[model samples]
Target: MRRLFPALLAVAAALAAAFLLLPLVALFARVSPGTLVVRAGQGAFRDALVVSLKTSLIAHAIVLGVGTPAAYLLATRRFRGRSLLVGVLELPLVLPPAVAGISLLAAFGANGLLGGTLDALGLRIPFTQAAVVLAVVFVASPFYLRAAIAAFEAVDPRLLEASRTLGAGPGRTFARVALPLAAGGLAAGSSLAWARGLGEFGATLMFAGSLRGVTQTLPLAIYAELNVDYPVALAIGALLVLVSVAVLLVIRLVPSWTRFASIWPTASAASSSR
Candidate 1:
């Protein structure tokens, strides 16, 4: 019975692997690599590719810059309504993509919550390239923020205390000690957020309007090309798959980043010498 159970589990695992991998295999099989390169380099595909890379990278930078501090705060502090705040921050993770789009529009759309204020400032957000960035940030940041909070929380509290004892301020401790120790988890989170932003579709379509060269990203390009040029759509999908695989590879290497934790003691020594 034990042997039979193991064999059944193996069969199920194989099935799951096939279920996940076969579609990707089919997508790449549909087009030759040379054709994919040609299509991806020409016409609207090129424009969409450029826009996606630009906006997704920008969104990732914004998340890392802003969300890191925010995550650190939430992870290190115990305060009133912290749980509520965390819940609100993570809400986007569960939100439907269409709903996420609508949420952005409600917050930044002309006639939205801040619409009048933004217009008064001469900044229109919806249906522009900036709107694509906003949409990506809105949807992708939660992934990073969630991961970052867990990473920061995972740091050794004793190291932080030791840094303080060594005359390091809170900022110095965070920058020199906590940040290094958490690098592995942060990299993992960053990869997930970047990939999520790269594949963003529904919210961007809703908020950015899919204008070629302005707001159209690769996913939108894929949709636009599906009926008009099936081959081009497949090519774009293959490109996305390639990028996703690269992100996964980065995630696979995150354990190596744990080696950065060794820097914490070095930081404490520097602080002691000061």
Candidate 2:
């Protein structure tokens, strides 16, 4: 009975893997390499690729810069409402992308709460490149933030205490010790955030209006091309899938690499001592 159960589980796992991979294989089969190469030279494709790269990179920078400190604070401190605050930050992780767009609009759109003030100051966010960046950040930052918090929490407290006892300040200890120790996790989180930012569509479309050359990222461009240029859309979709797969590979491999590297040194030292 036990042997039969294991065989059944293996079959189920294989079926699940096939289910996930078949669509990707079909997508690739439908796209011609020659067409992809030709379309890659087109101005619209180039512009969308550039826009996606620019906005996603900037959004990732924002996530890393802001999320790191925020995570460190959450990991190191305990205060009233801390859990509530974390829940609020993580809300967007589970929130529908369309809802996130609407929320951004409500806060920053014309006639919104802060919108009038921004209008008076001659600052506008909606339907612009900045809006695309904002949308990406809103939907993607939480992934990095949550991972960062966990990474910081995993660090050995004794190392931090020792750093402090050696007269290092909080800032120094964090920069010198904590950051290095948590680098792998942080990289994984950043890659995930970048991938999310790259694939962001609904929030960007609703908030940024998909203006060509200004706000039309890869996903938006794919939508725009579906009716007018199906082949180009397929090419772009294939490119996006490739990028996404690369990011997923990094996210999956980084933690394992870090764990093995961490363990190897400890094992070696123990063996030498024996």
Candidate lDDT scores, in order, read 0.92, 0.90
lDDT of 2 by residue, 46-93 (tens): 889989989998888888889999999998889999999999999998
At residue 267, candidate 1 shows an lDDT of 57
Clashing pairs in 1: none
TM-score of 2: 0.91
Clash number for candidate 1: 0
Which pairs clash inside model 2?
A: none
In model 2, what lDDT does residue 5 have? Answer: 92
Worst 10 residues of 2 by lDDT: 259-268
Cα-based RMSD of the predictions, in order? 4.4, 2.5
Clashes per candidate, residues 3 or more apart or on different chains: 0, 0
